[model samples]
Target: MSAAISAERQHDLDTGAAASTHLAECLAVDFATLLQTAARLPVAAVQRMRDAASKGITQRMALAATLLREAGQGDVTHWQSHPSDTVRGWACYLIGSDAALDLPAKLQAMRPLADDPHFGVREWAWLALRADLVAAPLQALPLLLPWTEEASPYLRRFACEALRPRGVWATHITVFKQQPEHALPLLDALANDPERYVQDSVSNWLNDASKTQPTWVLDLCARWQREHSSAANAYIRTRAQRSLR
Candidate 1:
């Protein structure tokens, strides 16, 4: 591990803190230690996660969720409310990996995590179900449309962020890349959103599409500018076309 990771591990060891306050601490968190100390997971369970670390975060998280299920700790509500963000992230994967839950059920279960106060938990929320969304974009898009009008900017951001054509740290949505217009309802709803957080997500969503559908992006931006000339829309348009320019 790097010195930075060592320091973070040592800090958690010394402080016995259950939750991370920022993204770096979230990334550097030692799951084995946290599961043992904060979550009171059994030594065997903790060791499983420790061994899983070598596979990296995504796989580790998936394994953690599986372990939870096998141990009869599959109640996502309990994990979701855990003091540790990593544990809450485990809840996301639990929901994601569950083959029993359909798309609507999964989205309903994911709503709270999608708007989780911790940034890391919020990211895992969308990332957890991203594959399912990609598998069924037609069903997912309409289901997520209402999220754009949600009261919290985080929920609004999740509506777009979760469906980005080429999101970071996740698989691309080929349907959006080839047929970006399918997602226009979502894009249009948030076009004039006041929050910079939501605006950034919208811009990045468009930017992702622009890579494969530049003309579509340009036309959409031009239409938005013509219909609603707002600062938020302008910012989104500018950033969305950054790659094309």
Candidate 2:
């Protein structure tokens, strides 16, 4: 941990706070110690987490989920409702790593986590299933389309954030890169979203595609502006074209 990490923030990271207030706190979390001390996980499970802590955050999450199952703690109900957001994040990964679940099942399992109260858990919700989405972008698209219409902006954001051709801290979705049009349904649904959170995700999704298909992004923005000149649409268009500018 950096010396710059405050004592209070370090305590939160050590004790596994419900949510991290900043990126540094989230990054500095000691998962092995957290699982053993705060989460009361088995020694074997904590050992595995310690070994995997050096890996990327995503990998650590996946390993934690698997270890939970191997330790006979697979019932994610407890973890999902845990006070610690990291534990809830582990629940998201548990759902993602379940080989028994199909894409639709996984989406259903992820719904609550995608709309989690904690921002960190919501992020883990999408990140947990990104690999599955990349493997079947076409199938994932139609399934995720309904999420854009969800009442929660978090769910609405996940619909776009999860399918970005070039998402942050995730593998690229080559299919969406090659065929950006496939994402039109989800993008169009949120073109005039009322929430800034959802709007930013929509624009970011377009910006990601803009890298691979600038012309398509330009034309789409033109059509959106022409069809619906709402302030929300204008906002999305401007941000979507930021890279091009």
lDDT of each: 0.87, 0.87
What's the CA error at residue 20 for candidate 2, in Å?
A: 1.3
Measured against the true structure, the TM-scores of the candidates, in listed sequence, are 0.92, 0.95
In model 2, which range of ten residues has the least summed lDDT? 16-25
**Local accuracy of candidate 2 as per-residue lDDT tens digits, 61-171:** 888888788877888787888777888889999999889999999999889889888888999999999989999999999999998888999999999999999999999
Q: For model 1, how does the per-residue alpha-carbon lDDT over 24-52 read when each residue is reduced to its tens digit?
A: 67767676776666556678898888878
The true-versus-predicted C-alpha distance at residue 28 of model 1, in Å, is 0.8
Q: Candidate 2 — which residues are off by over 4 angstroms?
A: none
What stretches of model 1 exceed 4 Å from their correct place?
A: 1-16
**Pairs in steric clash, model 1:** none
